[model samples]
Target: MAADPAIRAIAALDDELRRGMYEFIRDARRPVTRDEAAAAVGISRKLAAFHLDKLVAAGVLHATFQRATGLRRVGRAPKVYEPTGGDIRVSLPPRQYDLLAGILLDAVLAAGADEGARDAAVRTARERGHEIGADHRRRTRPGRLGAERALTIATGLLESHGFAPARDSPRCVRLRNCPFHPLAERAPDTVCAINHAFLDGLLDGLDARSVTARLAPQAGECCVRLTATT
Candidate 1:
């Protein structure tokens, strides 16, 4: 398996001097020169350059060239280092929560209608879910998808997509993981609506008769639940 880049990034601060330099650059909140970093950490300029470049290679920091703002010797612009300002996560077994966030964020940003961002997110999520279901019907199985078989298909597909769906009964599917996560907790009214709409669209696209998607909010679980209709 490929190595986690986050591990290497964290390891970049293993040394005391390197850790100090990283903390100084991060707290500086501006492009910091190598000399500034060295003075702050009480290290030699040459040593600071070495540690800063190491941090760059490990993706903990980024370097750029900019001229000093005040009067100084006229020469090539000095290189400066800054924090990349990106999150570094190392979840066990990996996760794609960011991907889900990106999709919803895009939907929200693209929403220009007076109806609002929540409405747009729900609409976009349903459309996306429908596309997934329809593609599966087209590429995998062409027969009419009855509720039971449709649920089976959906569970497998959603699991692969990080929903962590569980078969609570022969008829109901409970999603244990909401990739939307803290965002869902922060705005259940909006995010739950999107989840419900998405699953509803998934069933509709599957042509799975007699199945219903509903809001079944529970702590430590997804807001949407699916069941075979009576």
Candidate 2:
């Protein structure tokens, strides 16, 4: 039941943004200018800049620069902004693993490997890993090397493949990306299989037996540790 630190951080950030956005638009009488928004939210202009930037990035606010009142200046008026058109809409909630977990569960049930899904998932993952390795072999040009020298190459390969692999510790590398955790909610087996496939492919030739994973339910911190085999 412990919260995943990563998930907690993201959730906190999302909440802060949501709160600031709400206050920024509360006046409802006029367009909420970014500076006005900052004052309303009780945050500094610079801090406001970052949050507003996120809002813009999330499509929650649209920006248009126009002239504002300038003090003791004979040049063009300072630029100002306000919420434009209509109230901005949030495209989607923060990315969570709920949906991904469900997908995995469904995949397993559909595959009819409920009881033995874990093993089946591992095999599926292994195959997928092999395919990825083969693809790497095809796409990579020259400078061929053995597995020992290929660690860096493999790491890069996994990154490009969307694994977001990071070295969490000396001997353990953790995976930070997974688009399937939401599916685990509905199809845990499927998610497990998909995760297995991902890690298998990612750590291919790095000693398969050395890998182990821990998936937090609804925490969105699914991690895989690449440990050395005894």
Candidate number with greatest lDDT? 1
RMSD of each: 7.2, 10.1
TM-score (C-alpha) between model 1 and the true structure: 0.58
Instruction: Give lDDT: candidate 2, residue 201.
Output: 63
lDDT of 1 by residue, 202-221 (tens): 87777777678888999878
TM-score of 2: 0.38
Native-referenced Cα lDDT, model 2: 0.52
The RMSD (Cα, Å) of candidate 2 is 10.1
**lDDT (Cα atoms) of all candidates against the true structure:** 0.83, 0.52
Candidate 2's displacement at residue 26, Å, is 39
Tell me each candidate's TM-score. Answer: 0.58, 0.38
Give the distance in Å from residue 59's predicted Cα in candidate 1 to where it truly belongs.
20
